[model samples]
Target: MTTDDKLVYMANQIARNFEALGHDHAVAATEDHMLSFWDPRMKARILALAVERADALGPVAAAALERLRAGVVPRPQTGATRFAAVDESGASDAG
Candidate 1:
């Protein structure tokens, strides 16, 4: 997938987890995650995607991004990918 699409997918995955906390909390958590883990260039890229193709994002992710764009910059943190690891034959380790 293109990096932009990957960003969207990643954000949606984050949302799926953060959503358990509730919508407002999910938005806050997502914003916190992006601000903390994503570098400026990555943030800018996703922000650009958020503006240019919001519909491409999942519902919670889109909402979270909107909250981020509206102003909620948190400090940066070390990043870790949420994508599942694939085994030799390409099956996700999740299964």
Candidate 2:
């Protein structure tokens, strides 16, 4: 898919996953809660991570975004855990 298409697709996937996890409100509140501490490049990375790590809310947003861009579908959130796994190399496995 085109880069924009991929970004929008990933965003939709993240929104779906968040809703599935009972955090629909948080997803809705994203525009309000989003911070602006990073530069343009870092901000893009954070947006990308938001899609990959739909379960987590922390400094790892950039990593999650990169993973999604690489075609990885993060592990579904379950139990008491809220974050998906980061690979050994700090990247995410696409499987």
Candidate 3:
């Protein structure tokens, strides 16, 4: 799969975990997670794919990507403790 596809699948998987929250909440949480965790380049690539193939993304993932692309959500603060809990891509959070 392409990088965009992998990110889409990963985002969808994240959305699935948040699914029980219901549609709107799930999308919001997913978008927040992406803004807080994903690298800027990854976000940009996904945003582009989101525009080109939004229907291919799951509903929640698509909505989240749209919010990211639109600048509706704020990126996490650099010194925020929330980021301490999240490992960067390909990095381990393992003890």
Candidate 1 versus truth, CA RMSD in Å, comes to 8.3
Residues 1-95, model 2: lDDT tens digits: 66645544544454454554345343432222222122466446556546654455432333344443455543333323233456344333343
- The lDDT for every candidate, in the order shown, is 0.77, 0.43, 0.79
Per-prediction tally of clashes:
1, 3, 0
Query: Residues 41-80, candidate 3, lDDT per residue (tens digit)?
Result: 9888888888888878899898888777787774432323
Task: Choose the strongest candidate by TM-score.
Answer: 3
Task: For model 3, give the 10-residue run with minimal summed lDDT.
Answer: 76-85
Which pairs of residues collide in candidate 1? 36-77
Candidate 1 vs candidate 2: the lDDT winner is 1
Higher TM-score: candidate 1 or 3?
A: 3
The reply for model 3, stretches above 4 Å from the true place, is 74-95
- Over the full model, what C-alpha lDDT does candidate 3 score relative to the true structure? 0.79
The true-versus-predicted C-alpha distance at residue 21 of model 2, in Å, is 4.4
Q: What is the lDDT of residue 12 in candidate 1?
A: 84
Query: What is the per-residue lDDT of model 1 for residues 3-84, given as tens digits with 9 covering 90 to 100?
Result: 8889888988988988877787777778888877788988888889988888888888898788778886644322443455
For candidate 3, what is the TM-score?
Answer: 0.73
